[model samples]
Target: MTDPIRIDVWSDIACPWCYIGKRNLENGLAVAGQDDDAPQVEVVYHSFELSPDTPVDFDGSSADFLAQHKGISIEQAHAMNDRVSQIARDQAGLHYRFDIQQHTNTVKAHELTHFAKEHGKQLEMTERIMSAYFLEGRHVGRIDDLVALAEEVGLDGAAARAALESDAYLPAVRADQEQARGYGINGVPFFVVDGKYGISGAQPAEAFTQVARQVWAEHQV
Candidate 1:
């Protein structure tokens, strides 16, 4: 059997397209039969903060944040979010209620993802966190909130809290950032396939399937 294809993805919970890209990747895996009998493809989610400096309690709306950060108007932000939300619904069956989204920094949440990886629930926890942030209106920037979310994913709440309180797994988060920088990654939803091929943004599932097939074929030789 060939070695598993390694897929490293850099993303942020606050990034709508990251979530979309995740679904699209999953769709690609399903279509390619990579999820079934092919050489294994291990997925690793890395941290990339879209709003590292955002306050725990953001006073403004999502539109405001986008306007301030991207220099776009509120109307444009809403339109953009609407388009992405519709895409997500079609692609991932995820219903993103943009009005309910809580805009907060996700540094600590990313740290918790590292912790969850140790427990073999990294992907589950990542999905949960993203859903909490984008759909359920959970506060993702605080340690306490993260602990609660961790518990929902079958992790020990107290231990998760302690880990967050002590800055545990922070180095791992930084390491992810450093690795992205080394790879010249400047955007979220960046996918590196088999340590060589790079696919950026929320590309279609066919694109991912093509890349996966190419990488798998190369490994077979």
Candidate 2:
């Protein structure tokens, strides 16, 4: 049996491109599978907080936060987001509602993802949280909100809440960040394939497809 390709992904809950990159990678893998023998794949998500200092309840829209963070005008921030929104819609088939997005510190959300990983619902949990943040405008920084999302993904809500309350998974989140630092990765949505190859940022589906095929072919040789 062929060994599965392990992809370690570093992403943040508030990152719009991370969601789009996830979709593009999935789409690319699907395309590759159709063109050749489908390779088994294992994806592991790690924590990367783009704005660790952000408050749990930011007092403005995503655009306002972006404006401040990037030191740009609110109008420029909106224009930047507009371009990204269009790209997300066209490339990843995702509808982003940044106007209503709750810009919050993702450390707690990252902790929840670690909790979900322990329960074998990491992927579902991550996807749901991203959707909640970018699409549904749900709060992801609070324990209560995260627990509700965990339940939506078929996890035990109470257990999730308990885990968050106890900071049981905060270590795991910190560990992931430490590892990212060792890897010299300072950005979200960074992809590491098979412990060697690094693909940064949100590339097109073709890029993922090509990389998957190349890595698979090399491993077989």
Candidate 3:
């Protein structure tokens, strides 16, 4: 068997574009090759905080959080969020409920993600976390909440809860951030393909396909 292509994804759970980028990458894979002929790829998610300073329980709505955090008017924040939400719905097929989203720190959530990775459920946990935050209006900052979500994805709830409480994967999250800094990545949904090619932002599916096919051709040579 040939080696699987490796893709390192640096993104935040709160970033809507990250999810959009994930969808685009999937579409790109479908365009790149068939189920049998497609290059084997492993997507490893890393931690990035869009708002590291966000409180565990923000006192207001997502709009209020954005306005206060970015020093913009609530009206402006709502408009921006609306535009993003529309894009998610139309282009990405993701339902984003920013109005009800819990604006909180994602450090612990990243920790849970690392835990899920250790248990071989990282992808499922990552998707579930993003969906819970963006679509289901779940508060991902709390340990109890995260524990429940972990269990929903076939992980041990109590173990996940204990890990979070202990900050078990905090170092891994920090290390991932340090690596991002080393790579000079300051944004979410950044993709590093095969440790050589870098794809930034929520690029179109064609972009991913081109990169995937090009990398595969080179890798096969």
Best by lDDT: 2
Clashes of each: 0, 0, 0
Clashes of 2: 0
Residue 181 displacement in candidate 2 (angstroms): 0.6
For model 1, residues 1-221, the per-residue Cα lDDT tens digits are 68889999999888999998998898888777744546468999999887788887888888788888899999999998889989999878889978978788888999999999999999999999998988888888888889989999999998898888999889999999999999999998999987788889999888878777778778878
- Sort every candidate by TM-score, greatest first: 2, 3, 1
Model 2: lDDT of residue 199: 95
The residue pairs that clash in candidate 2, if any, are none
Local error of candidate 3 at 127, Å?
Answer: 0.1
Residue pairs of candidate 3 with colliding backbone atoms: none
Where is model 3 more than 4 Å wrong at Cα? Answer: none
RMSD (Å) per prediction: 1.5, 0.9, 1.2
72-97 in candidate 2: lDDT tens per residue?
99999999999999999999999999
Query: Using alpha carbons, what is the TM-score of model 1?
Result: 0.95
Cα lDDT of model 3 by residue, 84-194, tens digit: 898888877888988688888889999999999999999999999999999999999999999999999999998999999999899999999999999999998999998
- Candidate 2, residue 44: lDDT: 95
Model 3, residue 73: displacement in angstroms?
A: 1.3
